[model samples]
Target: MTASTPSELIARSRRLGADPRNTNYAGGNTSAKGTGIDPVTGEPVELLWVKGSGGDLGTLTEAGLAVLRLDRVRALVDVYPGVQREDEMVAAFDYCLHGKGGAAPSIDTAMHALVDAAHVDHMHPDSGIAIATAADGEELTSRIFAGKVVWVPWRRPGFQLGLDIAEIKRQNPQAIGCILGGHGITAWGETSEEAEANSLWIIHTAEAYIGEHGRSDPFGGVRAGYEALPQAERRAKAAALAPTIRGLASTDKPMVGHFTDSDDVLEFLAGEKAADLAALGTSCPDHFLRTKVKPMLLDLPAGASVDASIARLTELHEQYRADYRAYYDAHADASSPAMRGADPLIVLIPGVGMFSYGANKQTARVAGEFYVNAIHVMRGAEALSTYTPISDAEKLRIEYWALEDAKLQRMPKPKSHQGRIALVTGAASGIGKAIATRLAAEGACVVVADLDLEKAQSAAAELGNADVAIGVAANVADADAVQAALDATLLAFGGIDLVVNNAGLSLSKPLLETTEQDWDLQHDVMAKGSFFVAKAAARALIAQGMGGDIVYISSKNSVFAGPNNIAYSATKADQAHQVRLLAVELGEHGVRVNGINPDGVVRGSGIFASGWGANRAATYGVKEEDLGQFYANRTILKREVVPENVADAVYVLTGPELSRTTGLHVPVDSGVAAAFLR
Candidate 1:
C-alpha cells in the first residue's frame, strides 16, 4: 500500500500546499520514503523525498523535493543526544542529500525520516491549528479524535523533537496522526492517498465540531458599508491613506504599505471584538515569522482631516514599535541575534481594513495575505470557544530561529529595480504592454491599466508572475478613472515610482473633414488624459517625498504634422507641451517629466489595430500590406520601429541614464530631420 514512487507524494504535497487554509505560505513540509538507486553509488538505498526549505507547496515541483538518504538523516538523532542541535542537524540534513545539487531539505527532515509510515504529510491547517494551539489542546484532541490521534507537547523543531516524535509513534502504533500542541498537525499512512485523507478528515472533523459547539456569529451585525462603495471611491480612500501609512511604517530602510479591503477584511475590521480578537496573536507560530506575533490596532477616526489623520497614525505607529520592543525584551533569548526592527508587519485600522508593510510590494502583499488568513483562523477559534494561540515566548523562538534566518541570508541579491513600482496605462496591448513587460523583467512590480478590463486582466496574467503584476480598468479620458487607476496602483503596490502615460487614440481625418466629436475625443484622451495622469502621479510622488519618473507616449506628429492627421497631431502636440509644463512645475518635488515621440509604429501596435495604419496607407496611395515598409523607408535609417523601440526610450528617461534631464523629447523615429528635437 506504500507509495511506490515519489510522484504520488509530490502530488499529495501540492494538493495540501495549494490551499492557504491547509498550509499557510511555506508553513508545511511533506515527505515520502522508498527504495531508490543512489546517484553516487549504484546500490539500492532508502531515500526520503521531503519538501525543501523555501519552496511553496502550492507550486512545488519534483526538483523542489529534496532526495535524502533516510538512514543518513535518522542517524543524526544520535549526533546530539539530549542537546538541541539545530545548526548541526541542518548540516547533517545537507550531508544526507542523495544527489549532487538541489535545495537543502526542510529542517523537519529528521522527524519525517523517523516516522514509521512510508508517506507522511505535515501542515498548519487553520482548523487543526485552532485546536492544536488551544490551552487545553491535549484534552481537546483526546476528547474529539480519541484513539485516532496522539497529542505531543510543543517542542522546538529539531533533532530532539524528531526523537520525541519517534518515541510517541512507537508508543501509539495504531494512531493515524499526531497533533503537535501549539504547532501543527501531522498525518501518516502506508500510502500517500491514505495520509492525505487522514489529514483532511482531521481538519474537517475539527471544523465540524467547532461549527456545532462554537458561539453563534459574533460578527453578524458588524457594518461593512465601506466595501459597498464604488470601486473608484474605495480605491481613493485606500490611496489617500497609503502614503501616510508608508511614511509612518518607514524605518532606517524605506517600507511600502499594501492595503486590502476585501469582504473578509472589512468584516474583520467591522467586528465589535476586532481589537480583542487581534490581540490573541496568530493561530500558528509560523505566521509570527511573517506577520509579527500580533498586529497593531490603530484607532482611525472617521471624520478626521487628512493632516490630523496622518499625525494620529504617526503617533500610533511609534507607539506600536515601542510596544513591539517591550514584547521582544520580555521574551527574547540573550543568545539570539539582535532583534529585528520592531515595526509591525500587519496594521489593523478599524473602519479602514488592514495594511501590511514590507520593503517592497510583494512582501507587503504576502504579509497582508497572512494577516487575512490569521483573521479567518482567529475568528473560527473564537466562535468555538475562547481563542488561544502560542505564547509570545514561542513566537520569539520561531521569529529568531537561526535556521530560518540562515535561509534568508543565503538568498540572492535583488535586481536593480527590486523595490520600485510601475504603472503602465493602455497596457492591454502594443507599446503599453511592451513597457509593462520590460518593467516587470527589470524587477519592478507593474500595474497594467487599460480601458478594457478583461484585456487588462489577461495581459497581467500573461506577465506570468502573480506577485509582479495586477490589472485595473481605467479610461484615460475620465479624470475620476485616472485617479482610480493610480489608487489601484497604490493599493496593489504601496506607491507609484514610475508612471507611463501611454494611453491614446488616433483620428486620421483632415481638418476640414474632422467633426467636433472626433476632435473632442482625440483631445480628451490624448491631451487631457496625459495631463490628468501626470498631475495625479506627481501629487502622489510629492507626498511620498520620493523622486519619480513620468514618461508620456507622444507622437512624431507632435513635431511634424502629417497631411490628414489634424486631430491626432494636434492632441499629441498638446501632450508634448503638457509634459514640459509638468516637468517645470514638478521639478521642485524631484519629479521628472519626459516624453517619447515614436513614429510610424504600424506593425504590432494599437494604431494599426484601430485602423489608422490602413487609413494612412490609403491616403498615401499604397496597399495596406506596404504600410510598415513605407514608414520604415521614410526614416533616414530605413529601419522599422517596433513597440520595444519606443519602450526602450521610456526606460532611458525613467532610469538613471537621464536623471538630470527633464522636459525633454526623445524621438524613436530613426532620424527624421524635421521631427528632430531642436
Candidate 2:
C-alpha cells in the first residue's frame, strides 16, 4: 500500500459503509492508508478522513468527509491552542493532507488528530449522559461499559474538549473511545468505517441492556390516551377547567391525553408514595437549569369539583416552590449570583403526565428525554427498593458549574425597565401576588390587578412602602377593561418599566367534560389578557431608549397536560411561545420579556384552593391537609412555596440583579424544578 495506490484503503472504506449491521446513527470515522507503513504491507501511504458533521453514521460517504494529513494534524494539536484566528486553526493542518471539498472536518477533529489511532468516531448516545449524571452514574457506566470504555465528566466543547480527549487517549492507547460523562462518546478503529461501525455496535449494545432491564409501562402503545373521546365530553371538561392551564398549553387542540393506567406512572402518581417518586427529574442537571427540577402533582379525589382540582394543583405547586426555596437556600453559595424567576424545572401531575420547559429546543429536549429515562429508572428503583437522587455535592456542582453559571449571566439584560415601574396581574394571591409584591419591594412601582379587586387593593396596600403601589380592577380578558387598567397604571406610575402578566384562574375537569365557554373564558384571561397587558406595556417601555421587562406567570402544567386540566396547561404552553416571540420582536426595542413560573402558591391567600396537592391527595386517598406536608417532605429540600419566595424572584428579575437576563423563565419551585422525578 504505497502512496501511489491509495485506492485500496479507500475501496475498503466504501465496503465498510455497506455493512448491514450498521443501522445506528451512533456513527464513527476512521482514516488509515498506511501511516508508518503496516509491518506486512511495508508502504508509506497515510489516510486521514474524519466523519462529517450532521449525517448519520449508518450511511456516510467520501462526500461526508474531511481528509487531512495524519501526522501533520497531530502536530498542529500540540500548539494550536495559542492560535487566535480562524485561518490559524484551519491552516495549522498540512495542505497536502486534504481529502475532499465542502465537508468540514468533524468538530472533534483536533482530538482525533492527536490520538495514536488512524481512525476515530464520536457519538452522543442517549444512555451515556443518562447514566453519567445520575446518582449512580459511575456504577451504571462501569456496569454497562465494563472494561470497554473510559469516562470524563461534563466540560465545554471545542479546543478544551478536544484537548481532554487527547489526554485520555494518551493514557489508554488501546481504549476504543472515552465515555465523556454527561456529554458523549469518542471511539476509534483502524479504518474510518471500522471506527464508525464500532461506535454503533457499542451504543446499541448498551441501549439493548437498558431496554431489557429498565422499567416497562402498561400504557405503552397509545400516544395520547382517550384522545378519541366524545367532543361534548372534552368541551365540557375543558370549559369547566380551562382557566387553570391558561398560557401553559394549547387548549385549542381538540383532544388532549393523560397517563392514567401505566402501573409505572400510576405508582409514581400514587398519592401515598412521595419518597419513591419525589426524587424524579430529567436524568441530568442541565435539564434543571433548562426545564426546572420538579413538577406540580395534581391528584384530586373522585368527586372533586373543577375549582377544587385547581386549588389542589395550586397548593401542590406552592409546596413545591417552598421546597425549592429551601433547597436553594441550603445549597446556594451566598456569594453566587442570585437565581431569578419562579418557574419550577419540571412539573409532574400524577395521573395526567409531566411537562418540561426550557429556553430552547435542545434544553427542552434534554428535559423531556431526561424525564422519560428518569421515569424508567425511578420505576425500576421502586421495584428494587427506594430511589435516591445524586448527592447534593454532585448536583450542586453541575447546577452551579462555572460554565452554566456563566451562561446564566450571558443572557441579554433589559435596560429601559431598570429601576422603574412594574405591574403584576392577578396580584391578589398565589404566584401572581408574590411577583407583584416582590417587584414593589425591588424599587419598582407596582400595580396589582385582579378580578378580586378588594384583594388586589389589599395586596397593593401591603406592597406600597418601597415603591408606589396601586390596586386596579379589570377583567384581563376584556380589551376595554385591560386598556383602562393600563391607562390607570400609566396615570399613577408615570410609565411602565416591568409588566408581569401573572394573573390566573384555576379549574380542573377532564378534557371530555370541558366546556367551550369555559375554555374561552380561561384563554381570555390567562392568554389574551396577558397579551394585551404586555402589548400595552411594550409600547410604553419601547418608547424610551432603555429596555423594559415583561414577565408572564406560566405553570408547570404547560409542559405536560395533566389529568383534568388540559385547558390550563395548553394556555401556559402558549405563554412560553409568547415569550420566545416577544424576545425576537422586542429585542430591537430593548424590551426584555420573560416568565416566572411558580408551581403552587396556595398558602398566602388561599384563593386558589384547587391545585396539584389537593387533587393528588384525593386520588391517593390522603386528606387535603396532608398534601402540603407530603409534597414538601418529599422534595429534595423538603421545603414549600411561599408568597415571599416568589416575591423575591420578582425582586431579582425586575432590578439590576439580572440586568443581562431576558427571555428566561425562573422556576422558584425549589429543586422540584430540578429534581429527577417529575
lDDT of 1 by residue, 114-221 (tens): 888888888888878777766677888898897798999888777777778878888998888888877788888888888999988888888887788767775445
Stretches off by above 4 angstroms in model 1 are 1-3, 39-41, 81-84, 100-102, 217-236, 250-259, 301-309, 325-342, 357-363, 509-517, 561-566, 609-611, 618-624, 634-636, 656-661
Against the hidden reference, what TM-scores do the models get?
Answer: 0.89, 0.41
The best candidate in terms of TM-score: 1
- Estimate the overall C-alpha local distance difference test score of candidate 1: 0.80
**Measured by C-alpha RMSD in angstroms, how accurate is candidate 2?**
22.3
Candidate 2 — what's its lDDT?
Answer: 0.57
- Candidate 2 wrongly placed segments (more than 4 Å): 1-124, 129-146, 151-174, 180-185, 190-192, 211-280, 296-305, 329-335, 359-366, 376-390, 405-678
